[model samples]
Target: MVNWSLKAIDYEVYNGVTVGDLILVFAILFIAFLIAKIIAMSLRRSLADKMKKGEIEALVKFVYAVVMLTAIVTVTPILGLNLTGLLVAGGIAGIAIGFASQKVVSNLLSGLFLIAERPVKIGDQIIVGNVAGFVEDMKIMSTIIRTYDGLYVRIPNETLFTSNITNPAANSARRFDYTINVRYMDDAEKAIRIIKNVIEEHPFALKIPPPRVFVDSLGESGMSIVVNIWAPSSEWTDVKMDLLWKIKIELERNGIQIPTKRNLA
Candidate 1:
């Protein structure tokens, strides 16, 4: 014969929670939260000291999310939550979120590649598409540019990856080419010699490669002479403008007449 009362007594177990145990569990969780916060702050300070400002910002945000997640996991068992079940749920949620944020993830990865490659850096002058500006800030999603007119432009990382980037200041030397049309009647050889001298005398011009002046072609209007000069990249624009003005002034001062519409006839 089966003893039902004896079987019931054997199966019974003490699994009930007490007030004191609950208090201890809560205290442990509180302490864990505080410790996580302290550790996160310390990590942030260390990373900030070694990394770029934009990189530090991203790293700090990641650390904060991780710290909060760890705290949540530490407290889950105390709250009687099944760890395995929670993990399964979390995995499914993460998959969904990842799919939805695919573009965001792509941009972030592209931005990281840009920073590592350093094709362009902060304060570099760049021309992307029709936009020309100095790089002000580089972030995970996009880059900020301050235009010459004081306008702020936000360009996505994806665009930068695909477009042609013109970095004028990438090298220390740059070339300036300009054409001057003078009357065929004037001494073309003398004019060429004079222009070469002017370029060589310029303070901004480079002497290594030397300046060049040659007759480009005989146009319908006049004789075309091309002037090519090399200078430091930093002085490119200023040198180009000043060279043009100086050439004009010197040519007129030397009685060298520039071709006009009336000369074309």
Candidate 2:
């Protein structure tokens, strides 16, 4: 009558792994997993506004791996299993695998540095190592890019880290230049005024750093007039195309010759 049922529940299984021990082990492991998840979620919440999606994902994965490894090591001995041989075997295997995939490891490390350094971000228009595209996704080993023509490219992180990266979207404004050729007889000063007027008429071009048009060089066929304008980077392409069209139309309306040898000389 002295809690016989409880006594029966305390039966041993094998090699110090009793019924109670099994229950305790499960509880410990369950708590460990839950704690790991909680910590991962907390880190996500805390860094949500600070880091990119890729960085957060990597950090969460790293945290979970460390937590689970610690829990496995702590509970292994309690389960009455000898890990002496297993540890030795695992160490040797790990070393072998590490050496075999050294380049993969290098890419992984480079990806981490890419995240930390943040030379480019998702959706940024960039040119890296002869590839030009908007970043689609940043992964641990490689980066995905969507080219202007819609081709998808995957660049290894090692290449991305080592190569030169050009981010045109990083700055607020960009410059576009056009070398306009005209007959030597065409009034250079008048042509300059016409180009400046067209630039001013267009709203996208920056005004504070006024556009300039001048004779850059003198050639046998014509005068090499140079036009330089700065516009907001976001509208760079549109403005560039529009300005070229406008300049050509004005030059033609004023009967300015582009001085082709066939037409002028």
Candidate 3:
């Protein structure tokens, strides 16, 4: 029984490829995978602050693939495969497959371009096509987005490349407008002055572009006052929410009220 087991362990599988060769192939592959994982972990730690999460992941995946492919090619000889002939055959097959999968090629090229161009980065809130969300990851073939409502969306690179992308975070500053209505009986000039003071009090509101407050239109219920305020894009949402209520409160304190239809009647 021991002799038979020893013979089975040392037997040649095919083409002079023994059981030892198979074991060596697996060992090399395991080593390659371990090395790849170690390198990826090291890179993530080194580039955490220097690069975005999506970029780091993309780079790590690329490195891992290259390492595994190299190991595979190197171990092919253990299985009695020829590298030179395989490369030549692979080149011809790649060309034929490339022609057949034009869209796949296009997506791959688009992904490369996006990584290089960096029109939109990971964590950027963007609206591409009909989807509006924060970019979760930028992959080689597609992009992942986490929507405002917390749904994950995958967009193909080809579609992203061809579509219009609106990245509000790209700008240092952004403008938001509010159409505030005041009672027609209230002094329009006084309301304007009060609104300006409120904007000036807010730290996020930009003073360079200046705040614009003026009577836009006279409606049946009240006078429509246009309020255009500029704030840093990063804080625009908070500024919009915080300053708007303040404006209303300040106006009310100054004896300027938002007239209702009942009051007009």
Candidate 4:
């Protein structure tokens, strides 16, 4: 019939942190989490029209992280954990942990650099090392990309920061080249004219840079005609797919044929 109360537990302390201290720490953490969520919601609502999704997300994440970190630091004294003594007591373990966390620190710094440098933004089509995709989001430790085939990939920020990044979409215009082979007997000049006409018909093709179609080389089976086209960076893929087959069809309509093994013979 003894009554148990929080006051009765206050005298009992383990490792300098009482049971009440643990409860208070948890309570503070829960409140901090709620505050962060509320702040994030408010930020999204206020910034929805003023910022892009990625920018808003980055801002919200940064704020939330700061709030959580502040909460942890504020409560550390209540937990009575002695960082100095712990480090001194476990010097070897500390070194091992530091070594293991090197990559994490590297990723964090790289992410910060990416945010500041902005070589590629969300929705940008980019090629990083062997990976090519549209940037989905930039997180604190990693970047998310949605590949052309719609597969999701997560790349460590450290890797992305160190890799060669190719962002064709960063420029207003993009160029793509194609090599079309015509049968040696067909008119290479007429083929070039047809290809040029096809490029001009496409809406996305740039007239300023001007398309180039010329006889590049003579292959064993045919004459190699190179077609270089400049198009709006945003529409280059559509322009490429639309114009390539059109050029082929128009050339065939005018009696020019792609060289095949049988055609070569």
Candidate 5:
């Protein structure tokens, strides 16, 4: 509706930037931003299946920042600024800032590496440092973990990179173990057989690798019956909880006395 087109009005009221040049620069900057956005969208589409949504979004933002910064730096000369002087000053400033924020730069670089390597992704349950929970999102500076206690935790990217990250869900299946202590007087062989039967009947426990039921250790308190079984990673927690209860109940029915206290006498 309004006249948005510029008609070569030099209109040099200011010393450096004329009205026409300013308008032209604005137009170019807008066009450059639009192009950068397009490129970002394209990248997101291409990498959708290869990475998590949060990581992809982070990558797109990084691309947008780079493209826009390059565009602005490239177009500034067209708007009558001293090109050589600005570049030299920018270089010096960049170097000084780099020195000042080396740690920050390190974290940002580590974040990029994480996004590419994908040790853990959004919705993955992991324990890193003191934080243990499902990863909420990952950014250039830090990673957000939604803890099991319903708290949000943020860890720096550099620390995340260096720390040992235990991802319980990294594999398709996971193994769980339980040590059941029985009184020394109980039939150890019978207890082992009862535990093995319980494991064999568990609906979620995998059968390919087979379950293990063996006498793990003979402590002063009693004999420790070790039970190890594997199940789908998604059901690992539930399987352990329910399977332990079933094993205990089944052992008790078979007269295998699981020691509740140390018989020191």
Candidate 6:
């Protein structure tokens, strides 16, 4: 109650901001913001030009945000604001945000590890759990996949890190095994020769390893012959589907009949 109005006027004169100082502070802030923007743009362009798509894009965006925030923090003190209070508030807010976004942070870190390790890459065919698809895109939080049946799938990075990955196409070569059953009365040796010939004639089959046909089992229905062949991984599907048709046509041409089961007593 001691002359509050008089004290207010006196304080204004003693420690008040001048118009010129205000303009200077504003100009500095503006210049700093412009500089930060330019740096961010330059960094973004450089990273985009050099890095792969998806996660790199997310990282660049995050960097830009950090740069802008740093510029604002640097300019705040110049505006006569309480920096200690601002920092304390920022710390409290960050703690809250961190707690709320723990899962998101985990995903981001997992994605970073994925990018660094390169266990999988774009265009690679991978199977995770029940999901099998080609990797279409990857980001900090998730990866996109396009299934063989034209379905789109989004899998979280955290899940990827925890799950098992089966990359069938990782290697250049893969093996295919076919089981053929022939009547016990049929000549097993003759059937084996015909099966080997069929595999050798297939254009997609790799000739280096050579095709192998062996009698694996003699079941109640027929004699089971196992045919194993090596082919390039890229041509696995085509070779698998077409081999049976080619084998059937060749067996028919050679008068090698597959025996059918009759009713038993």
The whole-model C-alpha lDDT of candidate 3 against the native structure comes to: 0.88
**Candidate 5 per-residue lDDT over residues 75-190, each given as its tens digit:** 77767667787668799888888787888768878887887798998889999977899899777778999998999999999999999999999999999889899998889999
Model 1 lDDT per residue over 1-265, tens place: 2576445534423344444445656776677668767866775666453346767667557656666677677766655667887668799888888886787767766776776677887888899999998989887678898998999999988788667999888988889899899998889998887888788889999997888899989987789999889989778889999989998888888878888877546
User: What is the TM-score of candidate 2?
Assistant: 0.72
Model 4 RMSD in angstroms: 8.9
The collision pairs in model 5 are none
Model 2 off-target regions past 4 Å?
1-42, 46-59, 67-96, 100-105
- Model 4 TM-score on a 0 to 1 scale: 0.69
RMSD of 1: 8.1
Q: Choose 3 or 4, whichever is better by TM-score.
A: 4
- Whole-model lDDT values for every prediction: 0.78, 0.86, 0.88, 0.86, 0.84, 0.77
- The positional error of residue 47 in candidate 3, measured at the CA in angstroms, is 12
Candidate 3 lDDT over 158-181, as tens digits, reads 999999999998998999999999
Q: Provide the global lDDT of candidate 4 against the true structure.
A: 0.86
Q: How many backbone clashes does every candidate have?
A: 0, 0, 0, 0, 0, 0
lDDT score at residue 173, model 2, on the 0-100 scale: 90
Model 1: ten consecutive residues of lowest lDDT: 9-18
Q: What is the TM-score of each candidate against the true structure?
A: 0.68, 0.72, 0.64, 0.69, 0.67, 0.69
Candidate 5 global TM-score: 0.67
1-265: candidate 6 lDDT, tens digit per residue: 5687545434432145444445566776677667766766765665464346665666766656666677677666545667786668799888888787888878877887887677888888899999998999877788888898989899999999889999888988888888887777678899888888888878989887877889999888778889888888888888988998888788778766666645221
Q: For all the candidates, what are their Cα RMSDs to the real structure? A: 8.1, 6.0, 9.9, 8.9, 7.5, 8.1
Residue 77 deviation, candidate 5, in Å?
Answer: 11
Cα lDDT tens digits, model 4, 9-28, are 57557776778888899999
lDDT pick, better of 1 and 2: 2
